[model samples]
Target: MATSSDSMLAISVFPSLTGAESVSDEELAKQSVINYVEAVQTGNIYESVKWVVDTRFSSTDEQLEQYKESLSSNPFSDVSIKSIVPASNDTFTASVELTRKDDGETNKVSYQVIKRTIVGRY
Candidate 1:
């Protein structure tokens, strides 16, 4: 059975449902950011790239390929998605905290405002 997180991720990424079931753009954008963070946490570059609207992390095919290869040994240990706030109709600001696996250090955080396309088509 899929968990609530999984369900939310699906709803956020794929907004289409039965007729008359619609997801707001803000909700979609918020979910997309969450999905992106989850992808990064799992070290799945392909998944992460799926949610990116522009060349924030990579701009070229070669760079994307390199990112795919780098997922094998992810630098971060854990990721905590703090908040997803809507910036505009199709944009959201996500706050995330990343923890290094090597040391027991914490307190590191980042805020990323992502603009998601209708279907994230590049």
Candidate 2:
């Protein structure tokens, strides 16, 4: 009773149902670091904050304001991920090279990225 189009739709939906093609923890951690760095480089505070779960910022609004202020004071022209190494089961250490917009000086910094699932309210 299924057409070719129906078969194709079922094929695509099968992976989502089975959860067989899920991304690994290491890969997810690496991607989080990359996304965070990209967001910071582009001055996207909203996106940047989404990748971070720091206790210093009391609220989302506070984090946004702080990130915005920090970015304005010390902005980077470019950020490149040099390496990402697994530190633990769900944690990764990423080495990144950043070029300062003010003086164009390149500096290497390492960031600890922890992958946590965000619970969605439906």
Determine the backbone clash count of candidate 2.
0
Q: Give each model's clash number.
A: 0, 0
Model 1 residue 69 distance off true place after TM-score fit, in angstroms:
6.3
> What shift in Å separates residue 73 of candidate 2 from its native position after superposition?
1.7
Please give, for residues 31-77, the per-residue lDDT of candidate 1 as tens digits: 66677768777777767756654334336575467666655543667
Best by lDDT: 2
TM-score of each: 0.59, 0.73
lDDT agreement with native, every candidate:
0.53, 0.63
Question: What would the per-residue lDDT of candidate 2 be over residues 1-122, giving only the tens digit for each residue?
Answer: 11111000000112233363485655655666776777778888887776677567678898789889989997988877788787776566777788888888787776666655444200
